[model samples]
Target: MEKRFISLIRFRVAKAQYLNMGLKFKKLLISFFSVFIILASFGLGNYFGKSQCKVCPPEEIDFSLFWEAYHNLQEKFVDKEKLDIQKMIYGAISGMVKSLEDPYTVFLKPEESKRFIEDVTGTFEGVGMEIGIRKGQLQVIAPLEGTPAQRVGLRAGDKILEINGTSTVDMIVEEAVNLIRGPKDTEVTLTILREGWEKPKEFKIVRDIVEVPSLKWEVKRPASGYPDIAYIKLYQFSEKASFDFSKAAIEIMESPCKKIILDLRNNPGGYLEVAQDISGWFLERGEIVVIEDFGGKKEQKIYKAQGPSQFLDYPIVILINAGSASGSEILAGALRDNRGILLIGEKSFGKGSVQELEKLKEGSSLKITVARWLTPKGELIADKGLEPDIEVEMTEEDYEAGRDPQLDKAIEVIKNL
Candidate 1:
């Protein structure tokens, strides 16, 4: 009986010992996997950290100050609830773009980018005037003829002091544009300082749905016995400008007047291809119309006339002024260089830099100046505008009295031609 009881006790002790060994083995396996999982997770985090930091050179650029400022603003700003991280990012980008000091190179926020698209598509509501920053002042590049701006006598080279009573002292070009544009029939007042005026004049203009027509033509009816001349005014190089120009050219061809006077006085440019197309009407195919200089980094692009010449020897006289720019300047420069046509008026608006629009994330856009415009004669039209063969100045008196001496002089020149 004693031997049986001892055997039972021995078996119970062996079973407890086996259970303890199995538990220890299971704990050891769990410990090993936990360490392995921790090591794997740290390795993955390190790999991703290096990948993200690869974009910025840590050795050369220390973003400590920038981060410090950002953190300080978050900690100290009184209106913490009003702080917009997205707007702060946009402002940072705008500041970076502004550091370039090029007025044409602009960073547009999403809303501003939407308006810019409307501006490019020529389907916006505003006074029909092209505005630009010139000599640190907001200036009117050109006002479309028969538009609200021109009807109110907005001249190119007019320095804008205020828009809608808001001082434009430190206003960006796009901001001023936004203030000037509104729903149709809304009024916007502009305080403009003319060249010869002692005081700035306030001109209240009603905004409208600005529709820019490319070309307008009529037979010039001069007093009594003047030579028959066809008058063609190119307002802008908008969409379908080439087709409209073709139709106008056909009408001019069918007219009795062989001599044509191209009025590019207040034409602020549009499409670059449209300029080339219009130049094709007076230049032979393969003739150089304009040159695109990419700062010698790439081959300078030479734009040549692709279409046939419609008025090669028709003795065309082009009228220009301070308002003539971009495609207008290109056409005037091309016709004068390739066809020996004469230009008569003030120097053109020197907006010759080529801009390319790049769309970014979240419907935002960036417009950067990519290249400069060079005439066929290799004249840089950036700051040095195209000089007319005959320099005719339109004085303030001419404006007040509604006299167009520029057109009159062009008429006189065409008669001699």
Candidate 2:
């Protein structure tokens, strides 16, 4: 976008320079016509002199694919019972996103849209659960700590079979999330079947305003017992990820610890650069953390550590659950491949696709799936996720008992190392 604006300015300056040059009446007429042509051609960018989406009048919107979607919904869509025109509108919007095949480009109804915008603004209220659909079931990917979901014993691998008696078997993740989350003090009933639980369990949880804690750090004293392990929990690879990670790493280094536990259990990735920057801390001067193969060309990224790796000699036990996705998976995979850390927990979420969000006219945007990222060992973490050196499961009973078997196991593993 910045390059586009600069290019536009350069084009205008060149045109002005051409006008300033004294010319005959005939040349002036030609320049006037040239200026008219250039003004009419409101090009965003040009590749080898070919225009990028030639800007036409607003009347040309009839030919737009969005218009076709609206027409299709009005005429051909079936089911009159509980049929909502707004739902059709939302579906049409979703169609635009799906066309790009970007999984992170989510479509939301009016209320959901509002919530998303609010969340992006860095504040919101609700149970604060990162939800997703897996194997045609509404799954609890992760519940933010201190939120109602986690407070009420919502585990990451728990399959939400029903929400308020309404079966969420085939429901969209967005719809299920909305159904599960509500205002503060509001109660939501969830029927869940945890990974190892034999019987389905039900929980009625009261909602609260969930402020997501982005960072968590704990210094374990007594080198004899826990090896003076420093634990850091990175929830997401968001805008603040790099800064937050640096702060946590620096703080952990301040403590006298021989082992580090980087907990990335339920982190649904945000920005790729965050992953790259964080990985750079552990990786040496020149090492390919991840590579992007986009058909004709392959882009290789060698992340170099800027600061001193304080815990390089120390054993690093990284925790990952089924919810660790995209950026988080990249870091985990990198460390695992490089043999710098031992990965503990279950298989990751496997969303190792890179997305490019293109801003369209108006307030809308188009997020397109650009390329698939591979770990340093050239392993694809897309549909096939990264396997853990130690696979573990969390049960409903374990949650109710106020025990984290995975974290406990990680502590034990580090102790042995």
Candidate 3:
């Protein structure tokens, strides 16, 4: 997987849907894949004709075109290279998915799909960074902490100009990742254009077996000056998120603090169910956590507080940024709409779409954006992001001065509350 191939794909797509494939991947794979299976295979049933329930034929559709193309490609391919029929079958399935023109709607072939499952669950080898489309350019969301990209000075907001000699303008995150990630000890060169640097810097990053710790917590101590304040940051939404977040909430509750800040910056949502469950801990029973509108019907679910929602009574504030998305947006949106909690930071990442993944036969799958998510007040957050109650953009001067304007504003709001 050369970085150069990723660059060519990136510039071609113009804009792409984001996410990944890996084995640190498995647990995350099963987490989301289970949801997809639950959504797809668990459906009641569908049929073309009337509700005629009868043991019918084995069901046959026209595959004449496929057979024709299969033979033509095998016999007429110009290079006379050997072709694997199995891989070709996978390619046809991949072609079906790509034909949709929806980047999020992807078809992962066997090996890459397997690698995807492994990479996300825990870790594997790669350049060590998260990539996404921001404003139609392939951008690094954030480099994995202590990984090759991070160690090489890759930062959030850095534009990926090229991988090797290929360009990356419109590539989707998935394909780009597949191109960038490889076995350990591989050398991948990245051309980066950052905000402050005048020239696009180049870095030769060595791939390694990267381990991603899903949960990491630090005590925002009374010893550090804010005896009454606690900060909890959740990086990603995974299968165990509900439990992980619950533990964090309990810690806040047991602490001698009157104020708490849940750090959702850089959190790109995961399990919708987990997000709903986590939101449940912040509000009383019967409160609407989120709503979904697929145009066919308005589907909404209300979550009830069961665990330690006792912290809900405290003067609580939420921290969000351009990195907060999906489940993050859902949690933030629920609190702001139902409890009137102040959201402090810049605008949210606004990935307000519900994705439905369909598993095709032969170890490949299709991930498609099925519906757009809405706030409790029916606010849509797809291309347009969630605006904060108090808009505060981070400034380089503020960074140099070692001051957090957003945190200051958040504390001010909490104090007033």
In the range 1-417, model 1's lDDT, one tens digit per residue, is: 899889999888999999999999999999999999999999999778878883545567787987898999999999998779999999888998988888899998888888888877658888989999887789999988778998998889999999888998866788889899999999999999989789999999999988777888999866667668999999998888899989988988888888899999889998899999888889999999999999978999999998778788788999988999999999999999887898999999988999899998899999999999999999999877889899999987888898999999988888877
Report lDDT per candidate: 0.89, 0.74, 0.73
Residue-level lDDT tens digits of model 3 in 16-103? 3332333446778789999987767645344433256554444477778878988898889986656877777767777776577654
Backbone collisions counted per model: 0, 0, 30
lDDT score, residue 275, model 2?
A: 82
Specify the highest-TM-score model's number. Answer: 1
Q: What clash count does candidate 1 reach?
A: 0
Model 2 spans with C-alpha error above 4 angstroms: 1-114, 165-170, 196-201, 221-227, 295-307, 356-367, 395-397
**TM-score per candidate:** 0.84, 0.69, 0.71
Clash-forming residue pairs, model 2: none
Q: How do all the candidates rank in terms of TM-score, highest first?
A: 1, 3, 2
Q: Which stretches of candidate 1 lie over 4 Å from their true place?
A: 1-60, 77-82, 221-227
Name the Cα RMSD for model 2: 15.8
